[model samples]
Target: MRTTDLQLASALGAWRRPGVALARALADAVGGAALDGRLRVGSPLPAERRAAAALGVSRGTLTAALDILRVEGWVDTRHGSGSTLRLPPEAAMRLAPVSAVGEDGAIDLRSAVPAAPHTAYQQALLRAAERSGPVLAESGETGPGLPALRSLIAGRYTEEGLVTRPEQILITSGARAALALLTAHLRPRAAAVEIPAYPAVLAGFRASGTRLAGFRVAADGWDLDQLHDAFRAAAGGVAYLVPDFQNPTGALMPDAARRTVARLAERYRVTVMADETMRDLDLRPAPSPLERIPRAVLVGSAAKTVWGGLRVGWIRGTAALVGELACHPLCEPLSAAPTQQLVAAELLRDPARVLDHRRTALRRQRDHLSGLLAGDSRWRFTVPPGGLALWLRLTDVRSDVVAAQSSAYGLELSPGQSFAADATCAHHLRLPYTSPITTLDRVAAVLDAACGGQGQGPRVPGPGR
Candidate 1:
């Protein structure tokens, strides 16, 4: 076929489907094959004018399609070089899941989700509904969250000696949203993240279009020196730290490191955003670094401790900064769902009643999974003393490929690369032990099939075990 005909044929396939937008369809079509491969090494793509004429799309629409491909890292365009595929089209698709996994169904260990159905949660919901009269019309002292919930969150900090005020609290849609708001305001020239951090956080940063640097968090501890170096390199960019039961690695920042980070931030005049989303949910209560180190932004969410659908999180900082964050542009939907805030408020009001069932269930799940994965030869992990997940480092295989293949066996896995600042995780996976025993056993069986029998793994049971 003539080159012109090939271009026309490709464009035809892209826009032939009805209902689906032409640009998106074009992306889905060329995204998996030709355009993806040709963009990698300064290879020339068909001239825009030629492609547009052949495909019968407006030049503007063709430009939009190329722009979409650029954002997704499929094609690199130059003034003279046209476009070059950065990686194989297949590699681009590798980033997307083959199928969607649901909450009520599937053995999904891809996220460190809190197990559901605790009596405490139902009781909290019931109490909130009883007091729902005031919140029906969205009338409240605090805009996004109920005053009581803010007070409760503030009180927790007060116990740690950080004099906090309810007015300084800005409840957000979720932990991810809270971070995005902060990133919007603190649009620094550059930013830093821990290598193998949370994937969602990584996604947020990408969406925000911020320059990023990455530092390693070691098994022994966070590389404090690397953190200091990163800050120094960025001058005064914001640094995101998950100090308590960190998402993917489950490495709790030590007290000394916390103090050291605070000191460095003060010296360098940089702001630290401490993520405490997984704090109180640990099996053993560990002291939070935010309470000890006052030089940072403290972010918390009920999702990890309670349920993912709660849609409530708070950013705690100096009263002045917190006030600014509350009125930030992102609060447009009027500060989270009112009913959800009301529910969180009721749950905070009676902690013991709301947390009793969750604590028991989490402990049981964590213990059972740890026991099952223990003695397995292919995986190794430092089973977290108190959280919903275990961070396992693969012995020899590449975890990214392994996770990609897991879906075929009815297992959903989170490859460590998803959390890295650079797309490079090949030896790690975050396994949330939130599955029931039977489900966990099934996961173990899959692991066995995937990685040869009784893989040499550590089954750690501390405190709860």
Candidate 2:
């Protein structure tokens, strides 16, 4: 993919800074873009002259910046052809922070995934092994998903007041895959998504070349007027929503907002894709939005509730839509591993015990982390009713700089801009409470030092600062 000068400039938001070398800042911006998957590997960059013009920088400065990128192996420059982006080994690991362990046993707070229920998981695995014979005896080809697992998931939705059928479910490897498949099948020209949403969602839509129309999800909750405008503008497109315990911010869309979204979606002829991955982590009771937006295609996953290792997720839509997705070329005929499906099904059969255990732990951790953050006046946040992370607004610090400096303190932080559709939310940061209370206490200390300028480390100034 060839990145346009305009796009590159947009990605290099606020590269110019006081007391910072322009060339180095430009290089850092490029590296940041590469690390964030914005400037993808092998992406051809615009010519140096054009890029410099776009950035309002001189050609000499651009050349020096390119030299830095080349030295850092973040870009490969050729005499005839232009420079192309490269993903350094360390940057590659940073991109997959969820699975990557930090050096010197650093604390990793980049991912919001929860810890698995060990005893319940062990029991589920044993039960799956015991029940494997019947599944193995069959051809082992499930078109949409394992029927038993689909039935279990559909039954759970039904119990939640949403009438669902097994036929309406198409299981996938995980929620991410489910969403990718939906986007591929829908192939909408534009998509309406919540600003400061899940990073993976934004990256996925951008990768698919879909124009995004973002609606800000404030700290309180969704603004129905803004949501209605976004829907009306993106009419005949698609809207991806995470109304139940929205990621990052953790704001739960009220029942009234859900109904308004349903009505607007219908009025504007928009296809609504509701992500319910965080629904099970509810610290407060809220009605399922699916009941209000019956036409919306819902996505669910066991990764959040039961275990991240399960990798079992499903899409719930009209039976016809399910059939279409099942037959879609992009859709893999076979679902996740049979063993995983069996384990997920076993866990789902009686999930209350396991879910309750997880919810209890998460609630305690959330409160503990919130209490810790409340001590500092510089940090202001609303304690979300549910969700794995807290979206914090830093009063006098830039989240990007703080996150960049946190590495020196052995803390891996996810800056807020990663979750934005554009280069906004620079003052925000997301800290997950998934870690143990002791670890969160340590995290708070590291965050305080990092934000308070107590550490001696190379700090990248915020854009235009």
Candidate 3:
């Protein structure tokens, strides 16, 4: 779908700020719009001279802006048809954060979960173990959650500008569990899920009998129109969104779009579930407040930030709603293990350390993975600002096919097709760089071979390993 001039103008509201370079601003505005779903991927952008004139800038500036988008994978430029707003894929967009380790025999590059900062975790665990002994003996099917952890979780959100109370929070086994509780409680007839979503989330919605209407999320962001349209099409039901550093794609929902969506949700009696599971892994300052929105539920977790093994995730909403949700049969008496709670609480006590350690460790791993795949032209690694893995774009191939072949090469990779709501994203791959740097080298080689030397080789089927 080619973006109309008026559409582009609206998305680029004030493409030119006083001191900001016109070219740079244009690129950011367009990229931001694409990332948030206001602009559709593959939508044709205005011609250089025409766009420049429309935005009251010189054609040279527009050309430079397009170059920026091209380099960033926001748009694809062709000689005759001009540039198009696109979410083709990204540098590391193909990677998914997985827990697979090479020690088990497979060079698991299939997932993008962060490598737990061992030293910090070891220290935190020691503290938790010491504290858990006393806390574990007296728990009596603790309702809502471990009180201290819930308070801590609530406090964490309070600090982030979201008003949350322990009473308003319900701790579950994991993010999936919390989501499952929400789906069960709301029991919407239909819902809209932003695609390239976490697989388990999709599963949760389906298991609860909610028909999912697909909405597209690009490497840049989401198309708000698709989001709003999906909501209306779904009769203003529930909308499940990963607004912060979304999994697989690494696109963060902008603040402006959040406001608009919040209004739309209220207007349509829609329930928006914002999953902030990766919010803690963000590499930069937040573009918007992670505050509670009206008629919405906020899901957060320490699984990604602290340790995935510690199944601690929560849902924050009005007391009435949370109370209702807690009664759902799906919401069992969840006493998230005492030790895990203690470890989480201890870790949460020093939010700065968790943030710093995650940022440093993930950044290092991202750089390591990028360096390993840097020479592979067929795979473009866009160092995401935050998340467990990189979203990679395959030059010309089906990700599912690539994934199947990669297994024979001893690489456990999750194909991009697994992340999309349908088959529209088959040309991508998710590579979670959770393994050690040394292990990543082996992963790159396996990928290179599986791709058939620059990804054009014949598909190699395994002989039943």
Error of 3 at 289 (Å): 6.6
Flag regions of model 3 displaced more than 4 Å. Answer: 1-101, 115-119, 122-126, 129-139, 285-295, 333-335, 371-377, 455-465
lDDT of 2 by residue, 1-465 (tens): 799999999877766533458997688778766755557679899988899999999999999999999987898888898899996543432212233223235777788876566667787889899989988997766679888999999898888888899999998988998999999988988888998888888899999999888888966998777787789778998999998889989998877788888888889889999999988788764534434455789988988887677888889999999999999876774367777889999888998877776776678668767876675678789999887889999898899999988777778789999998976899999998876543455577678778874433224322212
Q: Give a tens-digit lDDT track for model 1, residues 1-465.
A: 123435445533423333456786566455544432322233456778888777788888788888888876667777866775455322321211112213234456676675333455676689889988877765543554667778888887887678788877788878887888888888877777888788778777777787778888844568877888877765687888888777777777778888888887787777888898877765664433344556688888888766777788888888788777767766645366777888888766666533554565567657767776776558788767566678888898888767766666667788887888888667988777665443455566566555644454223112111
TM-score of each: 0.71, 0.74, 0.72
Best by lDDT: 2
Clashing pairs in 2: 14-463
Error in Å for residue 217 of model 2? 0.8
Native RMSD of candidate 1 (Å): 21.0
Mark the 10 consecutive residues where model 3 has the least summed lDDT. Answer: 90-99
Model 3, span 266-347: residue lDDT tens: 7777889988888877765443444445556888887777667768778888888878877777676443655667777887
lDDT of each: 0.68, 0.80, 0.72
What does the lDDT come to for candidate 2?
0.80
RMSD of 3: 17.3
